[model samples]
Target chain A: MQTLAAGPPPPVTPLVVIAIYLGLLLALALFSAKLFRGTSTDYFVASRSIGPFMLLMSVFGTTMTAFALVGSTGKAFQRGVGTYGLMASSSGLIHAACFFLIGIKLWAFGKRYGYVTQIQFFRDRYESNRLGYLLFPILVGLVIPYLLIGVLGAGKTIAGVTKGMFPETFAATGGSVPSWLTGLVICMVVLAYVFSGGSRAAAWANTFQTLVFMCMGLLAFYLISTKLGGLAKAIEAANGAHLVRTPSELEVASKAGTFTREVGVPSWMFLTYMFIPLSVGMFPHLFQHWLTARSAKSFRLTVIAHPLCIMIVWVPCVLIGLWATAAFAGGIEGTKPAALNKVIGGLPDANVGAVLSLMVKGLIGDPVVVGLVTAGILAAIMSSLDSQFLCLGTIFTNDIVLHRTGKNRFSDKQVVLIARSFVVAIVILTYLISLRGGNVFDLAVWSFSGFASLTPLVFAALYWRGATKMGAYASVVAAMGTWLYFFAQSGWGGEYTVFGGVMPVALSFGAGALAMLLVSALTPKPSQATIDKFFPKF
Target chain B: PQRLIVLLAIALAILHQDFWDSDALVFGFMPIGLFYHACYSLAAVCLWALTIKIAWPRHIEDWAEGG
Candidate 1:
């Protein structure tokens, strides 16, 4: 129920920081335009020329968005330690496992086929333009919701931090930058870079942002932990606050509700969690990365190194969430009852306010360092949002436009222009969606679950010759439909449900795979010539 | 083709859930830690093996061919 502080003067610094970053990003994009004059590949996939550290940075930056920083800490505020242990830790390890086993194979195939998008792989494997036709739309549909979550979260965070200082930083407008205007301007700058340079600019910017975010995050953690009496005192405070121990079955059921008697994670949801990694191949941004890897070796190395990056970035987030949970046990706003009543009629909208207060309080020892950490969070959100929207724009142009028109002859400049236009359109749509309000974390997870459901079929197409066009198509539709249906029913409470949790998503994947397997068995296979043409060494 | 691996990971993740949920176990140790380590090790081996099977030979050829 507590309200956030009124915004004004100190905020001008944050606005200045955002403008400088955007200007830099725009310059890079313009530079990328110079490179793009010669080839389409240079624009879209950076001619698959990324180095190891750059590849590592790009992957890291793209995945860890506002979800890992603010949203995660917020979740920790509500759920406690096991949320980190079960959800964050396990999911990361599982994702790493996928990287080792599946991601490497995709990289090899991407290299073999010179695939620009997941659609290319599907089209080749299935020998059906229909799959491409169906999947491009479905992938876009899935991306919209995910993009909504990421973009909205970024917008909201920017609005929160730089509430009334945009005019000062941007210097074009006479008045202060409204929250909406700030979000829109930031999105515009991101689009400018992404549209101009395509993946190359995103890659370089992401690398820079990733390094800065990591260093700042570590610095923030060091300051917070040392100031708050180190890990031992923090642990003692947390445990003393009864925030670290396992919740009772009743407690779990009451909070998670509808999933009773089951401890830890609800049993019914196990399959859903299982299917997510499969969706990796289907994520356009991730697929783009697959295409951008310089060689099979780079692809393999990138995937191998990704988990390490995920681990470092996420551990601090988990610790912060747990610490936030323990430190602010009255539920952030719950601690300030009088303020809550004055603000939102005793509601917990103050959770955001309270957590921010704690964060601000935690940084009392060093304001400059805190400012940098805040900048890092903004960078994380912007980096992920920019890459995702850029990739989504590319798919919209390449998959939907060029394919339907039956025209692959557009000049690189024209394609880039068209793609940038889509980026602008998508930003507007995302802003509208954000205004309607939804939990960014839940939306993000559902979006991932949606895309990931199709990952297994993509793998089959790339590696398994027995997979037919009909089967691959069936798998995609069925998996996507099943995922959409169950995920909607699961609600946004972040609890593992009996049916809708990870278990159902996994089942949907199985169902899709089975459909593909059976359908392929019944159908005529692609010719050996086609197979050799696409996957020669295999 | 990699669908099986995805499924196995999910299933093992479920087993991980079981380990965390339980107080008493068939063995003296916490099954969660045991399963977590076992899966991690097994996955590492598979990764190393796959790398060797496909990548190592290619590396050797590239080394020889480049020379």
Candidate 2:
């Protein structure tokens, strides 16, 4: 978006803006902690004090993340405009369905049984504490990659915004801020709020960040188009020679085109991407947030307003990515002075995640505006990271440590301490793993497949009378084993795709549902009493 | 009303079917297929708003505080 257009090296405005943003976040964390009652319930569920508007903002904020803003934009450059239909539209409808079908029921059960996590729900429903031995690792394992996406995304964005900050010292990064330092800074800022205020602070902070990213992102869109010469002119410049161009005949590739093997979306693959959103039905972070709702009425705003919020964030990101393809078609801006082209030219695939920031800096020619957009992108990312970190810590404390040893063995304060400690450990581990190279969007899709496969377990747990303990076990194994098989078969998904264009999640989803059905039928159903607990006669 | 909500979900999926997304534009600036979904997104929010008003399970809202 921002090419190295003729100008002084972009000022360190973004670095200053990011510093201001992080400082504000730390202050918010401190204030929320001050309001904390210092109870485990207070830490874990925010004492269930969140009202409707706050709940809606926090849930939508946590769900959006880098995937909605950065990943969608970057992926669009590679995949074309079909990226929007594949994700944003399906997500608009499917996510609300999950909130209704799973979230509300879980909250009611949580209030009834004093449950705070998904593991607690399953373990009690199946009458098996040993389920955690199988579940905790799988749940935590799946979530870490998703967490890495947020951290890695924030790092890449900051690196772009502050390109000249360490130009002399970091020769390879073109003096851009390095990702590792960026990652550490974000981890620390998120940890500050989550460690002290826990779920409540995450909710309050997410509400604020969600508003910031949305408003600032739209502003970036307006200013970027104006800088390129209004919306219509900008679109014409990018589209006439780039993505919006329709080929005469035959699905052929061009030097400017992002697609390699195919020119347009495959029919079957387009159909199956819908399954991807089903993963939210089982997301542990979402589960934790659902429990923090003050009442089932609180879910109303989230279910109704989520789609509009998604549209506001995604439309600009996707369009910007598409335009980048047209703008950087030659791959090097030889005619445009090197200083002006420095932000965009010469990077392979044009670095999709950083497009919006580059567009701001290169076009608007204002440091403060670029910095504001960088903060917005980081806001989209960090909002999700805090919730995931807090959820993992909660699962460790509630499911593994307390379930195995004894719930009463420790005081409430001690339990809260254990959760915070685990969150810190997980953050460090994820940040290290993110240092290795990968496409943020592809890696995210791989991670989503794992959770998508596990959705059947929750669906059956909530609604099916025929689901049994052995059946749940079989479903988990079948889904995960299929995921691992496909993940490895593709050589870690570098050239991954099923025999047809179908996504791997569809196959695993079928296997999981079948396993639950057949195993429950053969290996005896749970007593009607157990069923009665989950399926009460209301 | 509940049936209408279920129908809306089906329509949402079908509306995004993407069978013929290429070779067209809308408003002289957007692809016809992508443009269709952009409007679909707005409609989804409206549909869900109505569902919340008419079809959401009101009994669930009656959660006993100490349950």
Candidate 3:
């Protein structure tokens, strides 16, 4: 009697598009895995045969993440346009400098020593295998939270897209897809590609995802602006009301411990935030990606193109977040503009990234296109998660299992299996944590600070041959201590900073470098042979 | 490389000036600060390209490739 409804069953919804996207990802994984050579080398480092273009794609993809897409948008929503200068421009320059200094040198060393992980390089360069114990925990510990950023972003994005899709059973979360299911699904998809295709698959997936996100990001910007009565109108509207109210004569801090709406960003905090991007020079995932290079020349494209890529991806997302302040203020559907404040509440109440989704759904209303663009955002999030998951598995297998246990007993297959199992375990743990929820941008900034503080170690290792192992340990402790000090100063919410605006990284970076330089001077220098090995005559 | 690094550092300095953060929107559209960053990003691409062409240390770059 019903006759199956009307008109091609209304085509496919955004949820179906997402389902197709996931299915394609699995297919890509299985294909890559099938091509896998079944060697531990193949599984972990992709035989170090990746070329320049793919190298560019994978490295950029890994760097962007949900933080680049979701977190940047959200931060921009809270902080205003200064967010671009604070993160993107600084990242553009700092990341390239890092590639030239840290990435190229490490890749050369990795090739020479057949190094598979950062811990492996540190252990040998310092002539202290036990350093692995300290470094491994520190690196993996920092990374797990980074992984949570990706998983949490993915969950938020999916939940945003699927709003009202499950009204009957899932009315709890405004009928949107729940984060737990989204997190679990993302974890499984990333794990499959990583477990199957290994590093090559991750590299391949990253390339594809990066392309998707860039295109979809631009499209989303154009379409959303058009929906908001064009870019000029959108910006003009943003200059109005609570979105961009004229500054008050008196700048007062709110009960939430933040400056009132009228206060602009202080100059000192803006400068200090520059230190955060230096964290890239020390990211463990980046170290692994560097080792996958076919030659140092492969880095040429990455260095040159990376900033441009950052420009393309970041500018749009930042603008979109800023635009959302005005558009969301105007109201969604029949909702009155006057009711906006009560609806979204204050700065802390706004869901910046979620605003992106709501804008897409509201503005476009084309399910298929909305689905594709949402997939693009998801692509950016997952691309990084896969690389991170793979990197964590790698350090565990190479640094901990083989080096620490002194076990040559495991076969190549078993080594890959051990890595795969570790990846699965980490995925499950990250999924569970993501269900509890978090502010993706805030979590990412803290993780970046931790790694940024440790940057002195790598720079010292590469440039200063007299850097003794004891100094290495000292630098880690000092940096970690300062980091924790600042962390506790903020009551562990990663909120506080010195001088009101100066980021914690400013102090921690100084502490790390000073400790390394001073401790190395007092302690015994590394042997001349060791110096020759790493830092020989030009 | 040091000279190139200095040039890159200058690029960062030029872009980081808080002057851009003022209320000067580009053609009544893009924010001036963001517009400056867009230009800065392009300059970065050109600067790095020049660095690779002129300052690449071949010996150091090929150090581990047995070149």
Candidate 4:
């Protein structure tokens, strides 16, 4: 019954919240065992029978990951209104477009071929086992780091919110719990739910988690509004504290084509911030959601319903982030002199971190409320991690394993087992990788941008009739190589140059698309008969 | 019709940067809050129409069979 509304608790209170949340997750996992008994279709895609509302929740739940909750807000707090605003506002529109343009066509094709994974779809469409073999491994490689970030974020967030209740043994918090142990534990729990019930469990849990997360967000907004004398006053306070300042540090860094600049960025960068939405349609987990959709209509309806949820869910996060920025910046204004000094002295090095730390500390008023907020953050991370695990696992098992073997075949049971096993493996690998060290936020952007280059090949496969198998393979290789090269160079120079932080990704995607098109035209188009076989006349 | 939807989406995007200003005004059982949300919904609908009409054109079917 620990609620996050009232605030922080005594030293050991985080342990109680951790215990309760883990207990609930485990119970849900065990309960989902019934879903595991069905065939592979039942486990993976739920036999494509999911209704609209459920589908909407599933999509929303899966996408609202650690990045959506914590990373986005933290950036907003540090950088101002520019970083995530455009993305949050446009994500639903992007998703809906994907649905109308691709999801329906994908569903029609997937159902026809009994496609279970991206590789499967590619193989059918391209009519090239060799191409599938090549593409599969690359997808798995990209999926690993992307998947790792989500798992790592889940562990880090849990550790942060619970005040070190479930500490990592090796975590050098200068004496704090090591991130390794925390990551391992969180990863284990995620592995359990996914392994036990497979995709079905993930979908159901996603629905439940979505509700909990949304309610927490709404509650946070309500509390903030009421406590601060409503939205108008809060906005006024924000404005006064200069919290609405734009052209955040990232935008500035992006403009300079370097992360070396420690302060904020040029304001003009925010105006052209389209990569956020572009990345959404290209992200692996998002792509998996499209594949798992039950029907085209369900997909469209789900997208239609998604933005409303975003408006509600994100409002609190944005408000809270902004509120924290203002509250922390002003140094406990209107308070007694001694109290004001105390608040000012306790501030962290970073603005957003200081704000979050302060808010959590202030929660000392109610352990229950503290628990709920902590739960809310953990829920966000877990939702993201679970989906990432499943997506990567499916990519590897279907694309890498099955494709390489040229055994265009697997029983549903075997496929399910392979997928779950990969989930376990990925969780373990990510836990180990996260221990090596890097900023959580940095890892997220890099991981996604790393794969952003592949967008072109995907488009070619879906849209271009001239696309040839060799062309697809060539495009993926060239695009990925170029993108990776830039990513590495940026890291070496201590900044992502070329066109803001997103230039390399954009360029790579364009390069890949160009390569595919040119090669497709030069190489023979797949025979009409082959094309007919893969994409039959409706 | 498609052009109109596209125009509408562009308009909404242009306006998305500005925060909604709601001043309470009474209407039957609907609070000014609900009424405001309804207006927001209209904007959303326009955006939705823009999505289906332009981004996801119906002629996707023509391409579907070819490739």
Candidate 4 docking category? incorrect
The residue-by-residue lDDT of candidate 2 on A1-538, one tens digit each, is: 2435333556776678878988887888678788888999888889877888988888898888766666676666556677787789889888988998788889888988888899999998877777768988999988888898888787778776766666577768877878888888898889888998999999989988999899887887787666655555555544332343222112323336533333245677778888889988888998989999998888888888888888888888777666555544433222223343434433334355565555566567577887887788888898889999999999988898998789899999899889889988988888888888466545677888889899999999998888899999999999999989998887775435686688888898889999989998898788888887788733
Interface RMSD (Å), every candidate:
7.4, 2.9, 3.4, 7.5
Against the native chain B, what TM-score does each candidate's chain B reach? 0.41, 0.73, 0.62, 0.45
Candidate 2 CAPRI category: medium
- Top model by TM-score, which number? 2
Cα lDDT of model 1 by residue, A1-538, tens digit: 1223433444355456556666766676567656654466776788878877787787767777766666555554444444444455454555555555555555565555555677776776677887787887777777777766666655555554543345466455323444456566667777777766778888888887788777766776666666556654443443222243244342221212333222233334432454554556566887676567665556455555554555566555545555554433332222222232222112142243234324543334243553566667767877777777877777777778877776557866677677778887887787777667655555666677676677668667756878887788778778877776777667642433443344556666777878888888898889897776545442
TM-score of predicted structure 2, chain A: 0.91
TM accuracy, model 2 = 0.91
Kindly list the per-residue Cα lDDT of model 4 for residues A1-538, writing each as its tens digit.
0112322233556557766877887788668757566676666666766667777777788777755555545554554443334456655555555555556777667665667676677776777777776766676666666666666655555455554333354335522345676677788887888887766677777777788778766765666556556666554454222243323232112222433212232333333343434555556666666656655556656656676777677645655555544443443333222242244223332323333333433523355665666677677777777777877887777677776665547776777777778877877778778788565555455565555567666667777777888788778888878877877777722235465534456667777878888888888787797676655434
Instruction: Rank candidates by TM-score, best first.
Output: 2, 3, 4, 1
lDDT of 4 at A503: 45
Model 1, residue A316: C-alpha shift (Å): 1.5
- For candidate 3, lDDT tens digit of each residue in A1-538? 0011122222338889889888887787678778788898888889898999999999999998766766667666656676787788878888998998889888888887788888888988888977889888888888888888788777777776766667666879866778888888888888888988899999888888889889988988888777777778777656333222122222223235554442235677777887888898889888889888988889999999999999999998888777755533443332223333332323343344555565566567688878988898889989889999899889888888888666577988999999989888878878877778866545567788999999999999999988989999989999989988887777665445688668988999899999999999999988887887888432
Model 2 segments more than 4 A misplaced: A1-9, A168-173, A240-263, A328-350, A435-441, B21-24, B63-66
> Candidate 3: which docking quality band?
medium
Docking class of 1: incorrect
Best of the two (2, 3) by TM-score: 2
**Taking the tens digit of each residue's C-alpha lDDT, what string does model 3 give over B1-67?**
7686677677566567544325557978888767877888787787788888877767765568652
**TM-score, one value per model:** 0.79, 0.91, 0.91, 0.81
